[model samples]
Target: MSQVVFELQGKADAIKTESTLSAFIKNYPVLNGYTKRDFNLAPYWKIPTRKKEKISFETINITDSLKNGASFDDVLTSLEKGINRPFKNRKEHVAFCLITKGEKSYLAMTFDHLVFDARNAETFLDIFQEDFKGKKYDGSLNLKEPAHLSMWMEKFKAGQRVNRAFLKMADKIPPRVLPLSSGRKGFKFKILTFSKKESEAIAENAFSQAGYLMLMPYALSASVSAMHEIFAGRGDSGNYVIPVSIDTRKKEEVRRQFFFSNTSFFIFKVEAGLAARFPELLNSVKEQMYSQVKADLPGDICRASLLMRIAPPSILGSLLKIYLKGQIASFSFSYVGETAYESPYFMDNKIINMFHMPRVPVPPGIGIFFQKSKENLNVILSHLDGMLTDEESKKILSLLKSRLGVE
Candidate 1:
């Protein structure tokens, strides 16, 4: 199984909402299996497979745990503790925790990255809401055949020239590392949310000026460029790469697939000598991103998965560790679109706020996740603890906000 990359939290009215959610879980058996299945990864680095198992919703009452009234932070801390507890080996890959503090209750779900990527998680929430509303789940996920031995071999052979070109390019430019404080131990999480008007303004401006359907990559490119300029000073120049995760579910072949395990990364390179203005930088980002998409980089990357079966597990693990520590500067993931719970109210409780924090690997030590719900945009900045102090995090976020024209 892949690593547990993030945690998701939301609020709902205590008793009725809890009952409804529990019922929803029961009604949608897929959710149960998705949460309960155990991954088998041994013998070799073959594609991980899951075995279904029985798992029930885990509920906790913290009314007595909190001395008087607990603040949101207190509740969050407790929820994190509960959900982050290590799962039993060879057991479930997903877990749910319901925490109650006084009259308010919180729902926290933890997922193994292999089991649920951002798109799958959001789709799960949609199904949960549908089940809660008394709708039947048709279970119409049309998953394509898994990329097995033959498929991977075919793609690998076809992409040999492209892969060789990418290797040559990789050798010339070193991976760009963010200017974060060193000696960080753990991780720090922060969420920056924009008002409906601010989010709308950013979207409208991008569409009106560039005719771009998605504004995230442009905004991200502009922000990263602005931050690099500030940190690198006036005269320094270099090439930098930002690895952006792209969801593949939108592809017709994988449409509505319930399978959650997949890795699709697009590497966008920004050169200091070119595209300084926001608009120019945006065009550059779009061109590079679209170019990679046209090349079917995601499928090509998936083809590389076959190497897991061929290479020695020990060697593969070591190489991956080195890559994570040295070859990646930062990660940017965005889920910018409508979400299931857009009404601000769910199950009779005002859905206060919802956000996700992706795991931040050190050396690079920073991750930016964006989610748009209703008309609001929620941005989460996660960094290795000592890598970025609170003030520094705020500053980076401020730069991003200014770049997005949110301020």
Candidate 2:
């Protein structure tokens, strides 16, 4: 199962936070539900309206912060461990780890990607905060959705369109992708945070280079340019394929759509020969996104995805593997846009900073994510343990930073 994690750093009161979380879960029974499907039947969540209130919350004490006599950063080490810890079972789709380092506190919420997408995870937090503060909020009873068994022709047509898109991709150059090594698999990451001033400067450069209000294209172009070096050096002139994950929920849907994943992928590919040209890549991405959005490709894909509710997760993975020809993409890419949790304080503690650490799935065990908080932008470089060394990761990010006009 894939996982998405959020690391919020600040001071914390564990007892208070735990109580608030417990109350929050009681208000939303879907937290303890599990997805199950009978043979050939549509999957439905087995949510218990009367079950024990149990949550996976662990408090780790860093008695020995050092391993093998090497120094370790408290926050990162804790978060690395927190994100690595999977949910105990499918029914438990979320887990919390609170790490205390003297006065500094780090809270890591590791969520099952099947349970919540990236954007809604922030909304989940925001609502939790509202609950903790004793503020009234909308009821969550409207979150339950239908099996959506109707509209057969619409689904088949949507599937046809999505399949045609994939066929179109395969007709082009074979996607350039690295072989996923078998041994141990885990992610190594690099977080690049731009200061407010630097972020503004990059916004200016984005408008000048990509276009007005085109920050997503600008950031993506920079990352593509950064990764093009590695791809080019590998001596393969294949098309660079990137799947952009995006949220499809409206602002008003937050109250009713917080239970499951509400996201879609935008398939963006550029030929290796043109990947290095900033202007060309930017234009290609913009044009591709425009055409897809205009054609409602993302919406169609989401509608088609309902057909998978009958298949088990294992089968779904197998199908995806066959579709990708043993390679998923050049790499995964996404821009989460601005975070929705704009509160200055969380659980009465001033938030120092926030960043997402998603465990990008294995076939494509690498991802570059961008999100904005306040006026600053945070970029993350995540890849499997052996996919890139520490030096290589920093260098790739450095290249990205330089391309973004940041020192």
* Lowest summed lDDT window (length 10), candidate 1: 1-10
Superposed by TM-score, candidate 1 places the C-alpha of residue 247 at a distance from the truth, in angstroms, of 2.9
- lDDT, residue 342, model 2: 55
Question: RMSD for each model, in Å, please?
Answer: 5.7, 2.9
Candidate 2 lDDT tens digits, 1-407: 33333334554778877777876877666777887765559787888778547677877655543554223355566666667766777677778877766555667678877667777787788788887778767665465567887888998899888877776776334578766655263566678889999999999999998888889878888889998887676676678778888654555665567667777778887877777788888898899989899988898888888777666557656655556565568888888766777576678777766778887777678889887776778888878777776777888889999999988
Which candidate has the highest lDDT of all? 2
Stretches off by above 4 angstroms in model 2 are: 1-10, 38-40, 61-73, 171-173, 183-185, 248-250, 312-324
Per-residue C-alpha lDDT of model 1 across residues 1-407, encoded as one tens digit per residue: 11211222344444565466555555333333322212432222123244233343465565544465656556645554543356664334556666666666666566656556655665566566666667655767643343354565676664573455355435344554555565334456666778888988888877775676767676667567555644465333456556676553443323256446544777676765553566677778888778878877766666665656544546644553354444545444443344433334444455655656566544466677677665677877766656555677777788888777777
Q: Estimate each model's TM-score.
A: 0.74, 0.90
lDDT of the candidates, in the order given: 0.57, 0.75
